[model samples]
Target: MDAKLLEILVCPVCKGLLHLDKARQELICRGDRLAFAIKDGIPVMLESEARELPADEEVGQ
Candidate 1:
């Protein structure tokens, strides 16, 4: 992901800062416990498209 884009990206629901999980290729919103997928380098920011993070699931750095 582009640094500038990452800086501006946030959780759609909570407006919380997101962490790019490179390994998983997902934008992780810890505050909302959601993981937005990155498909073909574009983030799927739609709430319905986001996957809820399991209670014990850890968001990677």
Candidate 2:
């Protein structure tokens, strides 16, 4: 993921800050409990495309 893009990216649902999970290739929204996937270096920010984060998942900063 591009560093510039990550700085500007936010959760579509909550318009909140996102934490990039490099290992998972996903942008995590703690507030929304969603994970937006990064496919081919592009973030899938659509709510319909986001996956529901497991309740037990740790959203690390």
Candidate 3:
């Protein structure tokens, strides 16, 4: 992901900061517990497209 794009990207649901998980290729919003998938170097920020994070799941850096 581009650093500039990542800086401007925010959680679509909560408008909070997103941490990039390169391994999973997802942008994680800890506050909302949503995982936005990154496809073809673009982030899919839609809430409906996001994966709901389990309570026990760790939001990794």
Candidate 4:
């Protein structure tokens, strides 16, 4: 993901900062516990389309 784009992207639900998981191609919102998918270098920021994080998952940089 582009650094410029990642800087501006936030969680749709809580407007919180997102951590870009480049290897997984997902933008993770810890506050909302959601993972927004990034497909073909484009982030899919829709809340309805976000996937819920697994309860056992640990999120952060």
**Highest-lDDT candidate:** 3
Specify the poorest-scoring 10-residue window by lDDT in model 4: 52-61
Pairs of colliding residues, candidate 2? none
Answer with 3 or 4, whichever has the higher TM-score: 3
- Residue-wise C-alpha lDDT for candidate 4, range 1-61, written one tens digit per residue: 8999899988889999999887789999998899999998999999999999989988867
Candidate 1 vs 2: which has more TM-score: 1
Predicted candidate 3 versus true structure: per-residue lDDT over 1-61, tens digit per residue: 9999999999988899999999999999999999999999989999999999999998896
Candidate 4: list runs displaced more than 4 Å: none
lDDT of each: 0.93, 0.92, 0.94, 0.92
Q: Provide the TM-score for each candidate, comma-separated.
A: 0.94, 0.93, 0.95, 0.92
What residue pairs clash in candidate 1, if any at all? Answer: none
Per-residue lDDT tens digits for candidate 2, residues 6-61, read: 99998898899999999999999999999999999999999999999888978868
Error of 4 at 22 (Å): 1.3
* Candidate 3 overall lDDT versus native: 0.94
Candidate 1 per-residue lDDT, tens place, 1-61, comes to 9989999998999999999998889999988899999999999999999999998887676
RMSD to the hidden true structure, all candidates:
0.8, 0.8, 0.6, 0.8
